[model samples]
Target: MGFWDWLTGRDTPPPAPVPEVDPAPTEGDILASLDGVDQLISGGALPAVVRSRAARVTRLVRQTLPRLGSLGLGSYDSYSVVATATDYLPEAIGAYLRLPRDWADSRPVENGKTPLLLLIDQLDLLGATMEKIYDAANSTDAAALITHGKFLQERFGHSPAADLNVPTPPSGNSPDPFDLERP
Candidate 1:
């Protein structure tokens, strides 16, 4: 039925039009490239190189936090604006830092550090995993992972250390997805 007809109660509203957005590439497609690389790392399903890169990136961002905070306006809101405008560097770093050691081996192997390297690597793997999940139809597991990544990407993507001008908690009354640890 046409919209005009439905509006006049002549017929029920036609089904809502499906969005035209293109589906993102699948996880299987990217996983095919990673192959057994994930298994080689401490996390047993994340890439080590990606972890190293994420740690290095986070370290650099952490160094800039002080300078960024000191910029003009010097308010939390200003910090958020500047941070979000930059790039996803901060988020990548935050995700690396927030990763549970248990998931990637709590003990550090090199430089007397815990296996943070492995954890960071897992974040990179997670980015790839997100790309796949975004492409596929909704699954409980996939939804959970995507929700986690989205929060990390949105919250820490700009400046993980910078305080946002929102309430005590970023999203008021919003349930936290990360609170549920993936086992």
Candidate 2:
């Protein structure tokens, strides 16, 4: 090392880089963690409502997961969404399950929701995400797809102007699609 560099303390080597790791857990890992959460809640002295909520979380997770797998979420892109469900689902339920009964129900957090409410909301959001993922994955189902299409057709397929089969008046102004043409 040069004398000036050593004296100035400018020759220090950079620290070794930390290894990169996947942020999200696998579906199997999440399921396993959820089993732990289930056991904890089931064995706890928590109130019946808390126990029921935890049970519901487990039920939805179990129901959504296999369908997710069947929907071919094998790649990283598709599976990334599944990661949040696995991670947060257990954390929310487990947090409520682990907290003391009084604290979970009575103690208020900053957002006006008690710890229990927060947990329930998180679980609900997770359930909705799972449902959305399931719907997207199952889009290949022709009957269901057709059913949805038919519903949209009945509700919004025909505009007022189109329903009357009237030709739109020629105008210089921007045409309002909602403005029905007078026959």
Candidate 3:
């Protein structure tokens, strides 16, 4: 049975929860887990794995910036290097290196806003959002949010700005390939 099936009690009772295990995972462990997920997402090819993980790591840097403070500097550089190394996958690496610049140029800026804007755009990727959610949910505020409280409800429950509509992608002049394929 799959891991999810077992966890949801569809396959078998979860082996009795081991009493109070360590919650913190080492960096090596985290990277190993990421590597496995990268492989699954990109097949067994090393180049594909590197490209996929670099994209994921870039997203992670963006979403965690608020929490990272100054520690993100080295992490950002390492990710960039991984994205640029051509010995493994020259084309993929080149593509990854190009992303930050392209994303930067495309972002709107009024008065010399920092590159953080580009990072925020990167955070729009799902992996970054998921990381932020995970980090936030683990903080001390998690319990406060879970328990009923007026402050919590007022602060997080409603925001007019949150409802603002963003522009959508323009439709293409040509018919979609999928539409043409239909009988």
Candidate 4:
């Protein structure tokens, strides 16, 4: 509405909006922690089994992070992923790493289970827990897909033959005249 702008019939653009500070850790922040854990674990000289389980848990967390909102903010599942990235997973691995490898691997600290075995158990538990969270987080999308499919089916119509991939003869195709089974 300025005089020059009005005369020119051109409008001035509005100012850019400021981004609000989010309270929750963003994807980047979470990923950074996960990356840190990866570096820590990978840098240490650990057995393949340990590395595998840790990788599994980390992968689960990474996969689950995107759909985390589906699990709800401030929820236990969300917190678990965060904690695994930031604390639980790192701490367990770090504690094992701090101990002398040969001693830790050889000696039985708890009920005849070596530190390596205990670490594997912890990782397995974490991996399972992460899998549960990942499933829960992704269940929303699955539910949505099912709901959408149902809606489409209801709004249109179900095609059992098509759904089952069964084939039908083309229209206007002539049947074998010699066939006695022809209708």
Highest-lDDT candidate: 4
Task: Give the winner by TM-score.
Answer: 4
Q: Please give, for residues 1-183, the per-residue lDDT of candidate 4 as tens digits.
A: 789998887886777999998576768888898898889768858888999999999999989888878999899889989888888998999899989999999999999999999999999999999999999998898999999989988887975557787687677867867899777
**Predicted structure 4, TM vs. truth:** 0.74
Give stretches of model 3 more than 4 Å off.
Answer: 1-19, 44-54, 57-125, 128-183
Candidate 2 Cα lDDT to native: 0.67
What is candidate 1's lDDT per residue for 1-183, written digit by digit as tens?
A: 778987788866579998899453233432332332222333543345664554443333333333433333445433332332233434444455466647545666666555556445545554453333323323444678889988987887765446655556675867777878644
Q: Give the distance in Å from residue 72's predicted Cα in candidate 2 to where it truly belongs.
A: 5.9
Q: Which of the two, 1 or 3, has more TM-score?
A: 3
- Candidate models: Cα lDDT each: 0.46, 0.67, 0.46, 0.89
Q: What does candidate 3's lDDT look like per residue over 34-88, in tens digits?
A: 4544443364322343445555654463344344332343455333323322122
- Model 1: lowest-lDDT 10 consecutive positions: 30-39
> What TM-score goes with each of the models?
0.21, 0.52, 0.22, 0.74
